[model samples]
Target: MNKLSKLALSIGSVPAWAFTTGIVLAAESVKVNPPKYSVVSVGALLSGLVSAAIIIAAILAFVYLVWGGLNWLTSGGDKTKTEEAQKRITSAIIGLAIVAASWALIQLIANVFGLNFQEGITIPEIQTNK
Candidate 1:
């Protein structure tokens, strides 16, 4: 019912209270620090990636499933090959779905763990470079 929880719900994520840790750990990483992409940015990026992956995988799985089904129907009762195609299509679809869901699940878990889960509202430190 607070601002943070409202913001989280608006952003389609779990309530901030669920995650007790503040996720603003600002230690420099070994690799390049890519322009202060904070928790909100990372969450948005992750959501986008997961959604895209789900759409793509769903499309691919559907195409293969349809192809396999039609091949089976048109094969004139070819039991052996038809079964093989069916099995392959089924496996592919299941695998793709699992992969897509896995990413989404990971994102949700990370949110619950309070990793990369802050609202983007931090003022930047003033630079004094001469």
Candidate 2:
């Protein structure tokens, strides 16, 4: 296969590798402490994933903004290039604003529900008779 196809194949396999690794690690943990996996753990996992996604997106937005600034500086009186850079910067700013608004909305909902996003998830214990 060509280089582009090879690269695509490698990238496509990454999620499969991650999924397999996660399953293996989870199974090992279950073998060590079966009680650790519960509703609270799942909630905590979801929360962590969401936080990570937000952080990654914010970082990407900042990087795009910087890239646009660089492009603008390097345009050197070219109208088309300058306009493209301006568009990039504007889009990045808009994306950042949307992200901020979403974060605020999440915080507001969490507050209304009396939930702390920073805190670990709380799940009531269930009593089982052997």
lDDT of each: 0.69, 0.82
Error of 2 at 32 (Å): 5.3
Clashing pairs in 2: none
Model 1 regions lying over 4 Å from their true place: 1-43, 114-130
Residue pairs in candidate 1 whose N, alpha carbon or C atoms collide under 3 angstroms: none
Write candidate 2's Cα lDDT for 6-95 as tens digits. Answer: 999999999988867333333343445456544347667766776777888888999999999999999999999999999999999998
lDDT of 1 by residue, 51-114 (tens): 6777787778788788877777787878897887789778777877787777678668867865
lDDT value for model 1 = 0.69
